[model samples]
Target: MAPKAQTPSKGSKKAVTKTSKGSTAGKTEKKHKRRRKETYSIYIYKVLKQVHPDTGISSKAMSIMNSFVNDIFERIAAEASRLSHYN
Candidate 1:
């Protein structure tokens, strides 16, 4: 004869079971702070200096390069944002 399995009584502590879908009753959700992004001009200047140690970039040329890079970056960012919104 097979042995019978014992069932927990109504008041028994062992009757409680952990759920597959977990509870989040007491936990608070954390909001992460957004970090400020640094410009690529510093890196660009460094590379230019490394490539041409003897030659020098004029202030006006450097300014133009920085603005050009910024415009391209802004356009890329705008496109990504638009795609994400649609998706």
Candidate 2:
């Protein structure tokens, strides 16, 4: 048994209701626009002394190395800021 088409007097275009759950296609694009984590580098010098086997690297050198690393980090930050402006 076939059901009959109950047309609204015929010749009327069907209405397309918008989807309730919206589109998910644009979500991945939003994720791509997000910022990534900050990158950093570290350098450690390990030298063992035979006289004082427990002795590690010099404290003065460690301070100097840390300062140098921090300076480089600042430069990287500045460049990143500049790039962000251009983008």
Candidate 3:
């Protein structure tokens, strides 16, 4: 046979307390805001389509080409800035 459980009397009060472990208080997280990058405009795509009516380029190819061109320009600009003060 199981013993009966005891219940607290109505005259007594129960208290609940929570304790912090102090782990996150000393450390602060730094949030970095990303800068919006400039990209090729829709007008350029319209002009490209007008220039080559039957071009067999897919959207995926265009995306790859766009990123490659952007990377090249960024590198060239960096090199130019680095060499600007040399001569």
Could you tell me every candidate's TM-score relative to the true structure? 0.49, 0.38, 0.43
Assess the local accuracy of residue 30 in candidate 2 as a C-alpha lDDT between 0 and 100. 45
Q: Mind sharing the TM-score for model 1?
A: 0.49
Which lDDT tens digits does candidate 1 get at residues 16-40?
4322222332254444679987666
How would you order the candidates by lDDT, starting with the best?
1, 3, 2
Candidate with top TM-score is: 1
Cα lDDT for residue 38, candidate 1 = 62
The better candidate by TM-score, 1 or 3, is 1
Model 1: weakest 10-residue lDDT segment is: 17-26
Local distance difference test scores for all models: 0.70, 0.55, 0.62
> For residue 83, what is the lDDT in candidate 3?
100
| TM-score, ranked from best to worst | 1, 3, 2
Which residue runs does candidate 1 get wrong by more than 4 Å? 1-40
lDDT of 2 by residue, 7-80 (tens): 64242333222232224544444435678743222234432344566757667767776677778888999999
TM-score of model number 3: 0.43
Between candidates 1 and 3, which one is better according to lDDT? 1
In candidate 3, which residue pairs clash?
none
